[model samples]
Target: MTTTCLVVMGVSGSGKSTVARELADRLGWQMAEADEFHPEANIAKMRAGTPLTDDDREPWLRKLRDWITEHDEHGEDTVVACSALKRRYRDLLRESTARVRFVHLSGTGQVIGDRLAERSDHFMPPGLLGSQFDALEPLADDEDGTAVDVSGTPEQITDTALRALGLQEDAR
Candidate 1:
């Protein structure tokens, strides 16, 4: 059977995790958090309010890609929260055997920054939000994905994603 992987992607504080979790629960699909794939050095850099270079993110992205491929091999549909800020990174992820599509959580800097300022549980510092936006390359028309505004509640965002990705009927 064919499987589909939904990659919930965006800059930091864009609500990727929240939306992805809701989508995964509603769709009853396997889920993974991209941050879990980060190396300790990457986590430490972010905790220090330092932005990671492409080199620092390569291994992390590869791990995520591998995760997708592994799930695909098992014919399990999946949802993952990843900050695939660059087209190149998304390209690597698209190599999966599963139909890997993206759901980009988009929001203005002011909005996301405000949300980030209120968070204290994550290793990523609010100060790095700017760097995430700077590195982001919005999905091109050719890419199999849709961009959803992150200004809404998590449920609302997930609803939009389900409809946009044609997965509404799969919602449980």
Candidate 2:
């Protein structure tokens, strides 16, 4: 079956966007960075080192849900980079479609924090990485997705994800 949605998920600095962008390019899929969906208030809160509450994330999650449906119905494969820090947040995406697959980009706090430190332009502060981990629920092996370590280069991580998702040769 054609995979319609891919959630390149993880906490801050997990390289979700880097991997997801590469996967989407290979699959000819549209890419949506869930960060782009966050309202200014949420961004501001994170910038201030304040963790967001569930209510703060609801609108962002809903936007992702809508995008999943919008892209899937149009036969447009889409990859979304989202922290999806909790199971319930992922469930929101699941509500949109059964074809939604998740790719968990994972790394240790030090690794991710280091990566986030060198990153620029993003509103999510490195300070939020700890809080992100506090909210994460790693996917199980039986789950409908892949989990890849972000310790390698973006190419390596993306390759692992694509291969696991059976889109390895879609790079053509």
What is the number of backbone collisions in each predicted candidate, taken in the order shown? 0, 0
Cα-based lDDT for every prediction: 0.93, 0.86
lDDT of 2 by residue, 26-90 (tens): 78889999988999999899888899999999999998899888777777888899988788888
Give candidate 1 misplaced runs (Cα > 4 Å): none
Poorest 10 consecutive residues of model 1 by lDDT? 11-20
Q: For candidate 2, what is the lDDT? A: 0.86
